[model samples]
Target: MKNMNIQVKGTIAPGYGVASGKGGDSRFPQGTIEMQKPFFQELGLDLSPYFSGTLNISIHPHRYRVKSFKYTFINVKWSSIQPAEDFSFADCRILFNDSSFEGLIYYPHPDTKPDHFQAADILEVIAPKIDGLKYGDELILECDRTQIDIVIVKKFWKY
Candidate 1:
């Protein structure tokens, strides 16, 4: 377990809305939760300790290394209630100003994801909800570099 500090700066933004039930696939949240249950269970992780939904951040011009790993693919089967889907996740520590939270970064299989989510600058972070944060706010996230196997994938553009 090699630990390296990774720092990311970005502005808060609204995502697909599926996590908050505002729009998109209505069953997405439930399906994601269900799909993640067993994986977390196997790790002896308690889901009850965290909040549901993700914090979307948009980073433009700025580039940060993306860490990768051998992740388990979660198959969310479609039932009479919802559509089928696949999801993947990686664990990381999120640094927000003076606060820090342990969380997962979810990556939905490309075939099953919305176009807007495929942006290189957009990141979906799931953690216990943080208060006093709003859209357009700048934030910094620090995590172990090995967790995501990150490498700089883009060049920084001047605004």
Candidate 2:
């Protein structure tokens, strides 16, 4: 067997909130940050063939391209929710669909690697507002996990 070293250069596609208000964005003392409140949504973890495993399978330096998968949530009147009525909600994050989202790149692939890593090549939306908003009714979404094809250079660094 050969050494499995998968170098995943992952990224998290930026996402926008879908809510009944006037969208999300805020200007702070420094600059600005987009704030969004989605009406609601339901997302399930699905990893089929072509890329299915325990996230610990052996591979040599692999990079995965992740796109922002969106799923429609609740549909309010768009007038009920106030733009800045202080819904007492948390915040979220944004990312790209390429080698941008640095937080989602799990090198060893397993959460239980021999060397505990503080970082991984995995993309995710942090602390999204998807709990007690008004998300309900029907839902529709399209998602996929494609392998990021890139040239790998295996050169000796030290003698």
Q: Name the best candidate (by lDDT).
A: 1
* Angstrom error at residue 103, model 1: 1.1
TM-score, candidate number 1: 0.71
Per-residue CA lDDT of candidate 2, range 1-159, in tens? Answer: 112222333322222222111323322121111122222211221211111111121122432333322322222222322332211111112122221211111122232222223222222222223222132211111112232222344558896
Q: For candidate 2, what is the lDDT?
A: 0.23
What are the lDDT figures for the candidates, one per model?
Answer: 0.63, 0.23
Clashes of 1: 8
Candidate whose TM-score is highest: 1
